[model samples]
Target: MSLTMAILMLVGMWLSVAAAMLWGVLRIVRRHSHHHRPPLVPAKPQPVRRPRRPAGVH
Candidate 1:
């Protein structure tokens, strides 16, 4: 094979590998992603919890 053909084949192999990796990562990410994203909604506010005084002190 000519040097140019060898180089092109190597480049194509590398690009195909990168594309496959990207496809796998995208699949994983999409599988895990949810329609109901938790961070988008605001959490409920907690009521203030007052400390209780000791019966003897009071």
Candidate 2:
């Protein structure tokens, strides 16, 4: 109810909001930078071969 208490509460609320905004900005920047990275080349697939049966197997 006191003026000092009200001011403190307001400041705390402001700090919480500012911190949240900063965190969101940081996440956006990181995402943007990651998306801007060079595209990765796809790995070539090896040719498939049939498995050979053991010589002793009839």
Candidate 3:
């Protein structure tokens, strides 16, 4: 109920919130710092197959 106690409580709350925000920002920055590399050569293409019709239906 005293003014000093209320002020200290407010300051503590502010510091805790600020610390949490800073931690989250650092985590995000670290996560995105890595560069992902693609494969040097692309995969080989597959050949298409044609369906054969019945001997009498064609």
Winning model by TM-score = 2
Candidate 2, residue 18: how far the Cα is off, in Å: 0.3
Candidate 2, poorest ten consecutive residues by summed lDDT:
33-42
lDDT of each: 0.91, 0.93, 0.89
Candidate 1 local distance difference test against the native:
0.91
Clashing pairs in 3: none
lDDT: the better of candidates 2 and 3: 2
Provide TM-scores for the models: 0.60, 0.61, 0.58
Q: Which residue pairs of candidate 1 clash?
A: none
Model 1 per-residue lDDT tens digits across residues 1-56: 99999999999999999999999999988988865566655588778999999899
- Candidate 1 has what TM-score? 0.60
Q: Given candidate 2, what's the lDDT at residue 42?
A: 70
**Local accuracy of candidate 3 as per-residue lDDT tens digits, 1-58:** 9999999999999999999999999999888876555657758877888998889995
Model 1 regions lying over 4 Å from their true place: 39-58
Between 2 and 3, whose TM-score is larger? 2
TM-score-best of 1 and 3:
1
